[model samples]
Every structure is written in C-alpha cells, then in structure tokens.
Target: MDANGHVQPYIINKNMGKPMADFAPELPKKNADGVPIVEPTDEQKYMFDADGWLLIPNVLSEGEVEEMREWVKRLHFDPESLPDHERTILAGPTQRLIDHPVVMGMLNEFTANPALSSQECYGFSLGTCGYWYRTAPNRRTEGLKEARAFKPHNGNGLYRLPGDVHFYNSFPGKSFCPHMRVVWELNPVKYKQGGTLLVSGSHKAVYTAPDEIQDPDSDVWTTYECEPGSLLFFAEATTHSAHPWTNEENDRIAVPTLYNQVDGGFAEALKPDEKLLESMPPLRRTLFRDRYVANNVVGADFKRLWRV
Candidate 1:
C-alpha cells in the first residue's frame, strides 16, 4: 500500500531468460552450401516446389495401416477410456509419427530455412495436429468458387512482390518450401473419393487465385488417387479446400500434422505435460521440448512466412 492507502497492483511477470532445462530438438541436416538436406528425390522436390503439393504412395505398411485403423476407432469410440497420457501424449502406435522416417527429411529441410538475414541457426517447430474423418456422399455442393475460397491463412495476405518476404524461401536455385501440411491417409483414396482439393501451382503464383481455379471442381484443382498408406504433403500457401466425399461406400479417415517455422503462426498443439513427457523416450520427448540454440535466441531467427 502507498502512503495514501492506494494499493499498487503487483507485476509478477519477469523475463527469466531461457528456461533452464536440457532442451534439444531434432535439427536439420545441411549440405555444404548451407541448405538443409531433405530425403525427397530431385523430381519430388521439383513437384512440391512447382505444384505446392506431393503425394508419396504407400508410406505405411499394410499392417501399420490396419493398426492405425483400429487405433482411430478406439480413440473415437470412447476417448475417455484411455489414460490421460495416452490420450494427450498420443501414445502407442500413433507415437510412431513423431518423427516418421518417411516424411522427416522434407519436414526438417522445409522448417529450417531462415526468414531473414538476421536469423542464426535453423530449426522447425511442430504446429497443430488433428484427425479428420469423412463418410459417404454428402448433399452439400461439391465445387463452388468464391472470394473466400482457399485463400492463404497466414501472414499479410497471399500474393507478394518479387522482393517481399517469401515463406518457404522459394528462391531460384534453393527452391525448398518452408511450411508444409502432412496428411496420412488410413484408407485408399481413389479419384473423386473426397480427398482434399488443391489448386495446382498456386503456391508460387504471383497473382491472386482466379474464380475458375478456386472452384472446388475446377479443372485446375487436383485430388490424390493413392493407396491407403499414402503420405500427402502440401505447402500452406497453396490454395486448397476440403472436397465432399463422393465415393459413397467407405469412410475416409486421415490424420494431419502441420509443421511450421517456430516463428510463424498456427502453433496449436497439446502441450506435453510432465506426465506425458515422462512416459516418452528421450527422442520422442524432444518433439515437445522448445529448443534453445545459441544463434537463434529470438526463436524468430528461423525462416519462412506463408505470404501468398
């Protein structure tokens, strides 16, 4: 209390510097040229850079797919039945995806680019992740193009000028992308089977998406027709929308994990409580631990903004 009996509100928050803990993250492997190394073939990288999306067929084995199917059912049927750690930590078979070998190369490569010259070290952060399910044919309209259709969700709108901040660092020679959405399909995705719609080559387009291309059923928008174990990857800057399930026979279940620059937006994922981390191996626990590298103290030192 002050001399006049006017009470002062306490300011409790203070900058504690970095948290004192053994924080380690899966760092990206870089080549001699300082570009992060990715496992995708030259052609695959070209496809992703040009089209903004890539589909790797049969990343999961038959047995693994079956296991995932059952797990999803168990999770959806009575989620509360599982322990808090399993539910929140995403334990059991699902944990295999924390740094799945099939997709980690590209993820590490894309997430490590620097946003600006001021940044230091290179690293990526895990963003939001969730499951999706669709069944049968729906009555809702399949394809309709409008202004709000599949616009870029992050940063200062979509299209940018030549010298503007480019997310995913889409330069001439070093063409690896920055942000990516990884989707693991548990069931076969045949043509018109209700996969996500993507406007081809929209990721790098300098102009706004046209109404014709924005249409869900537009000829420019393409859908994947791959096996159940297929792994789908697309840059967030790419124009995309959900398409209605037109197969009408089987239910389509998919799990999508979004990984982005720690500096960028869309960082919504369940925090791993002590109990959850305790139950995980050191390697897996690294995924949840916020890293502290000497060069990149600001966290934003890393790269990429999803500017259209």
Candidate 2:
C-alpha cells in the first residue's frame, strides 16, 4: 500500500539473468536506403503534426462494421476458439481492421518516424490490441458523481515529464513516438453519450491540464462524437481518459490497438502460438514476429539478441 493506503497493483519477479537486449544505445541517425515499410500521405502528416491526433472517417463500410460488431460478441463468448494470434487477423471482413490500409499508413509514420530517417525505430509492430463493448442501458455510471464522469490517465503532468518512456512523452517532431494508438468505433458515439476523451494537443504539453479540462462535464477536453466506421488515431503521449458510457440506444463497441516501434518496450506476455502463425499468410504473420529474433532470421541490417 502507498502512504495514502489506496489499493495499488504491483508485480514481483525474482531477479533473473541479464536482459536479452539492452535498448539504451541510440539508433543509427540515417540510412540512405531506409524506406518506410508503410507510408502516410502528406495530408495525414500535417494533421498529426498540428494536433497530435487524427480522425480518419468511414474507412469501413456499413456491412463491414456490422460484421465486426457481431465478431466482437462471438469472440467475447468463445475467446478460446482462436489462438491469441488469429483473434485479429488482417484478412477477411471482421479481421480486416487488424491492418486497415489508412490506419496502417498513419501508424507506420508514427511508429517508424521517417522524420528521423527511421533511427528512433526501424519499423512498426503490434504491441497489444483489444476490443471493448459497453452494453446499452447499462448503469455502470449511475452512482458516480457528475464530477467523476471521466478519469484521466497518462502524459507528462505539471511540467514534469512522465517517467515511462513509452508514454507519448516527446514533443511532435522528436523521436518517433514509442507507442501509437488507434481506436475503431464500431458504433456511433454521440456527443456526451460517452466516448474517449482527450486533451487536444496535450501530448506535447509540458504542464498539467487545468481543472476545467479535467472536469468530466467540461468542454475543454475533446471527445470524438463520430460515426460507426470512423477511426481515431493518437500518440501515446496524449493525455487521455475514458468517458463513461451513458448511451441507452445501442452498445458501444470499440477496438483499441496499440502499435510500437519494432524495438520499443511491450508489456504483453503472450506470443502467437505456432498453429496460429503457420495458418497466416506471410504478410499477416509479419505483424506477430518477435522483432529481435525475427530480424536475425530475416537478414536485417540491425538485429538484437532475443535470448542469450
């Protein structure tokens, strides 16, 4: 327990041997032959540079969205049917979102950071991704005080940077963000019906958000009241919070994806089981490769030790 006695979570692991890779050394500053594996257009680059967030609207058709909405329920009901890897393949109607074209392009630029000539991160890879559903008419927010409607998390606060390196801590043009976030809204998120809330431009802010912005009811925070097929993309450094759902008409289904630089830290422990990998096309399987180990096998210029 902390000094305040509030409940906190911690993990204790006995000291093992040295880590398999030391990621502290700066990457090469430039690679003349280094071309981005995925590319974002000029417009996308501008929007993200100006706001730290971008909304790509209606990338999925109505039919595709419906299929994914149903898939969410099926997956939730029987998660064991598919190995963790195949749960979100990049092919087929429901799985197409695993690497939607526009989304990939944007994530590619953010995770690859061509501005630095790909030095910060060689390329982008999946860190973790998951689906969320808020059933309609659910009273998860019934007892909460209006002031507590949303809870904020992440970002540098009060002019002091966050200790976590992957928490979108850099300014707009620094090293490519260690983490890039993408959220696909499979249901309409109407204003105040509760969607993700973000402090617009806060990813680059060195100061804590003011009281007004933190208030759940305050308009100071930006909330995307978007359509079912819209996508929200943001850097991990952006201060963000979950806005509790108050929608009584329909359930809100969202898939939040976290992509990291090929060399960035990842907290997830699950790797794709062999059966899942063998079943995927080479292109799709590439997303699941263990960055360091896979690089060595692929004859990449830079490879790190996966296990000594």
Candidate 3:
C-alpha cells in the first residue's frame, strides 16, 4: 500500500486480436466466366459453410437399408437373439461407416488434423455410432402441425473459452470445425412430420441466440424431408435437436454419429466396446485410434491405426 494506496479490479482474458466483425457469409453464386468450375464437394462446402449442415440424399442402398433395419430392430427388440458385440451401433454392416469415404472426403476439412492426415495416420476419430429410435407418445389431441419440436443446443458463440473444439471459423474456400455429426435416417423424415432440427446459420453466431432462434415453437427453426438412407452432415457448432417421430406409420430409425479431430475429445465421448474394437479391419480401426499423435505416445506419424 505504498504511494496512492488505492485498489483496482484485476481481469484477465485472451487478447487473440482486435474485436471480431460480423459479415455476410453467402459465397458468390457465379464468377466472371458465368458458371464457374465446381468440384464434387463445392456445393456441399458452400451449403455447410453457410448453414453448417447439408444432406446427401439416399447414400445407403435399399438392400443396405433393409439389412440395417433388420439388425437395428433385432438389437433393440430382441437383443438376446444376437451376440453381445452385435448389440452396438457399430455392429457388422454399420462398421463400414467408421471410415466411409463420403464422410472422410467431406468432413476432412472440418475434423482432420491436416498435418497428421498428410502423414497418413488417420486424422479423424469416430466419437459415437448411435441408432436412435423414437416413437410418438399416446393420447394425441387436436391438429398438430408441429408439436414436441426438439430443443436446440451446442452452438458456437464468440465468448467461448480457448481449447474449445466445438467451434467454427471460416475463410474464403475454407472452413474449420473439429467436431461434426453425420445422421443417416433409415426411415423417412416427412415435412413437418419429424427430423433433426437445426438453426440454418447458427454455427457462426457471434452473439447469444435470439429468442426466435432458440424457441422450437418459432418457425425460425428448420428441418428436412428425406427418403430412407438419406444422410446429413452438420458441425457441432450448429444448434440442433431431434424432433419427435410424429409419423406412427413407421418408427424413426436414425443412426447419428459424431466425428472429431483424432487428437481432441469433446462432449466426454465414450469409447466403443472392446469386442467391437477387436472385430474391425485395419482402416475402420483407425477411427478409434488412441489420441496421442503430438508426442508419439500411441503410434507416431507414418503408422497404422491399430498399433501393437
């Protein structure tokens, strides 16, 4: 208490840079040459970058869908009939999705540790393989256009602390999101009937969500209508939730899986069963590789996913 003998409050925070500015995110539709050249994922990149989500219609085949349905139903309803290892979302056929090329190709930008991927060490990790089945509740009353709309959660806001992987940052021709979800519906999601609910562009929100965006009752939220086997990719930063299965005709059967950067962990994700791990082939096994690439704890760079 020398000199002035006064007190001042102390505050500490990140000084990453100057204050951030919000801007329009829509990419250019056309170029100087009229219609510009587009790659297979260019459209997807645009949609996902702008809205944080996109649906690839009908990725699984009819037979594949049916097979999955059989397994899912048997596992859910008649678990005793199948072995314990087959009781998981990663059971047999679904295991192929652990390293699906479509997911790897599309989400590589979002979840891959680029340097690690370049080293061919399988840069992405599978967070969870989920088979979600939901049915409407009993005792339905008057006409309901939208009831039981899913609650919104997990959006990336500017005030988040450092070391947060469930975040989104984008630049021209590039976007970064370390955590993403891929939802594959084995049953149809009809319009306003029920599906995954999302706020179109909330992944890049710079401020807290407004009342309208937060309320499922508000029409500001949106959902999709797709055939069975339709797939969707969305960043973890995007606020999303699942609508109830209003269509009692067929119960909703969706396999929504989360993927992430191999070296990071978000949401306290669980590891797949040991039996499931042992049964996988080399490539699929990579999705669940132990996370220790920086210091070469598990397998160093230039190594297989399953290291002894």
Candidate 4:
C-alpha cells in the first residue's frame, strides 16, 4: 500500500513459471558476432599463427587487478566458510566468479571475437592453486634452476608436482584439444618468481623431447613477468609452464581460462534460447562461420569460404 492512501504497485510480485520477458524488456545481444571483433594487429596474427600465444600487457585496469588480488588473499588465508574446492593455496575465484557477468563477458569476447575467426574452440579450465609446501622446493633443485633447459609438458589431466619445470608438451595419446588459455596473475612477478615460461615458435612444431630439441635462438622463448593486472593469452600447442616461485614469502596466484579452435558447426550443438537468437540479425548470425573456416575446407577445396 502507498503511504499517501493510494494503492501501491505490486513491487514484490512473483510470477513463477512465466516467461521472464513478458514482464521486462530484453537483454542486449552480447554475442552478436558469436566471436570477438577485436582484430589482432599484424604482429599479433603472426605470433598467434606461428607460436600460438600472445602476451597482452595491462589488459585490466589497476583497480580491477587489486580487486582480484584481494579476492585471492581472502580465499587463501580464510577457509572457514569456503568450499572444499576453493581451499587450495592456488585457488581461483568461487564458481560464482566464474559465472559472473565480467568473466562471462570476457570469455564471450575472446571466443566470439571476429578477429579470431570462428575456428577456435572455447572452454574453461578448472581453477587451480599451486602451493610450495605441498610440492617440491624449486630454487635449490638443478631441474628447477635452469628455466631455458626446462622440458615442456601439458597438464591435460591432473598431476601433482614437486618442483618448478617448463611444460613443453601435453600428455601423449591424450588428444590434447587445440585451444587458447587466459592466465590472470593474482600476484606480482619479480625476477625468478615463478610466473610463466613460454617457447615462442614451439607450438608450430610437433611435440619433442627436451634433449632432442635445441633452445630457440630467436626471442621466441622467454619468461613472462608482469604486474597483477596482466592477462596472458597463449595457444594450447605452445610450450609453456609455471615458472618456479622461489619467493617463500609470497604465494603465486593465477586464474587460468582455456579456449581453443573447434571444427565448424560446433555452435549448432549449444541449443541456445530462441528468444536470444531472435534478437540477433542474420548478418551477425553468420559471423561465427566467417571466423572459423574449417581446416579441411582450407586444405581441400580452398575456393570455398567455409566448410559447413
């Protein structure tokens, strides 16, 4: 009831089992292109095509970076009410954060971006935490000290490790899906503080043993050192790994998001909401095909723009 004697609108009315749109206006179509539109510069394209990774500096603002760091600290030190999954020292945000609009928007932007073309597959990696006490000592070990000599390995399934080593290849026989990964640094990177080590052109070559391959002479293989706000985008095929974090004083925190290129017609399987699809124009609907031209079509027909 209104205070002035007039009847008040049913502000708290509940309409269970009713279409939400019947009561409210529609939401903006964030996936108009079904891919990200931000075009990668020439250098970015070259790096991505050849090496399968790109280092983007200052992708997030200082404030946003601080907020993530605070969240990491809170999760790390306090476990009274946190879930068992989030108790690890290298925990990412709760499932709530993963579903948050900010994270979802970022994922959509990266996946649907027009520049990437629809050829890429997108998926999320389970948030992980790396703790020193639970693993091996990184500094004193000979295998951990030499970063360049570190062999590549993939964390496709799950494995526990004792020390720092460069990961160059994923598990053999495990159809390692081709994808990109977003690494959000929750902690700052000082020299030798395990950040991430990457080999530039390694993604183009087949998986090789450490002893069999020589170190790249070019500036391809290098350690990534950045502030907390930095976001790293790399190819799944790229050779990379967690750099050893010798700083026993501070813990290394990061949220890694993985995406990959898929075969064409993958989106057809999603079964999206009809109302959502209705709002988009036909041009925007076709954007997905434009982005991800199938490799088979590229190799076989070569004349056709798309496969399916």
Candidate 1 off by > 4 Å? 1-38, 113-122, 137-166, 268-270, 291-308
Local accuracy of candidate 2 as per-residue lDDT tens digits, 1-308 = 43334332221122254432422222222221232233455677777755677887787899888888878766666667865665653323554565566665665445642211223333456777777777544444542233224678665522443446545533433335666788999999888777888777776677766878668778767777888999998776777788777787766788888776554445442256677557554444445555542332222334232233
lDDT of 2 at 265: 47
Tell me the deviation in Å of residue 139 in model 4.
Answer: 12
Would you estimate the TM-scores of all the predictions? 0.71, 0.70, 0.76, 0.47
lDDT of each prediction vs. the true structure? 0.58, 0.59, 0.65, 0.41
Best-performing candidate as measured by TM-score:
3
Worst 10 residues of 2 by lDDT: 24-33
Tens-place lDDT digits, model 1, residues 168-199: 44544345444578899988777965788887
Minimal lDDT window, size 10, model 4: 19-28
lDDT of 3 by residue, 98-199 (tens): 455666666555566543453223566777777876665553333322344566787864245768766786655457677788888889888766788888
lDDT computed for candidate 2:
0.59
Candidate 3's clash total is 0
Model 4: lDDT to the true structure: 0.41
Clashes of 2: 2
